[model samples]
Target: MRNDVRALRLSGGLSQAELAGAMGVSRQTVNAIETGRYSPSLTLAVRLARYFERTVEEVFHVDCD
Candidate 1:
C-alpha cells in the first residue's frame, strides 16, 4: 500500500507527532505508516481520511502486483 500521508501532513502544517495525536496513535506508529513500514487498520484509515476531510481512496492507494 502507498499513501500521501507525508504530503498531506506537510500541506496541513502538521508534524508526525501532531498527526499521531489527532489520530490517538503513537508518533512511531504514524512514522511507520508514513514510511510504509506499517499499514494502518481499517478503522484507523477511516479516521485518518475523515481528519483530512478526504475519502480513504484519496488518502491511500493499494498497489496491485
Candidate 2:
C-alpha cells in the first residue's frame, strides 16, 4: 500500500506526534504508515480519512506490482 500521510500531515501543518495524538495512535505508528512500513486497518483508515476530511482513496492507494 502507498499513502500520502506525510504530505497530508505536513500540508495540514501537523507533526507526526500531533497526528498520532489526534488518531489515538503512537507517533511511531504514524511514522510507519507514512513510510509505507505498515498499513492501517479498515477502522483506523476510516478514522484517519475522517480526521483529514478526505476519502480513504484520497489518502491511500493499492500499489499494483
Candidate 3:
C-alpha cells in the first residue's frame, strides 16, 4: 500500500504530532503510516481521509504489481 500522507501533511503545514492528534493516533503511528511501515485500519483510513477533506482513494493507493 502507498499513500499521500506525507505530502498531505506537508501541504497542510501539519507536523506528525499534529496530524496524529487530529487522527487520534500516536505520532509514531502517523510516522509509520507516512513511511510505509504501517498500514492503517479501514476506520482509521476513513478518519484520515475525512480529516484531510479527501476520499480514501485520494489518500491511499493500491500498488498493483
Question: Which digits, one per residue and each the tens of the lDDT, describe model 2 over residues 1-65?
Answer: 89988999999999999999999999999999999999999999989988999999999998787
Q: Whose lDDT is higher: candidate 1's or candidate 2's?
A: 1
What lDDT does each candidate get?
A: 0.95, 0.94, 0.95
At residue 44, give the lDDT of candidate 3. 99
What would the per-residue lDDT of candidate 3 be over residues 1-65, giving only the tens digit for each residue? 89999999999999999999998899999999999999999999999999899999999998877
Evaluate residue 20 in candidate 1 and report its C-alpha lDDT on the 0 to 100 scale.
95
Stretches of model 2 off by over 4 angstroms after superposition: none
TM-score for each prediction?
0.95, 0.94, 0.94
- Model 3, C-alpha of 28: deviation from truth (Å): 0.4
Model 2 quality (TM-score)? 0.94
Q: Which pairs clash in the backbone of model 3?
A: none
Clashes of each: 0, 0, 0
Q: Determine which window of 10 residues in candidate 1 has minimal summed lDDT.
A: 1-10
Query: Which residue runs of candidate 3 sit more than 4 Å off their true CA positions?
Result: none
Query: Candidate order by TM-score, highest to lowest?
Result: 1, 3, 2
Clashing pairs in 2: none
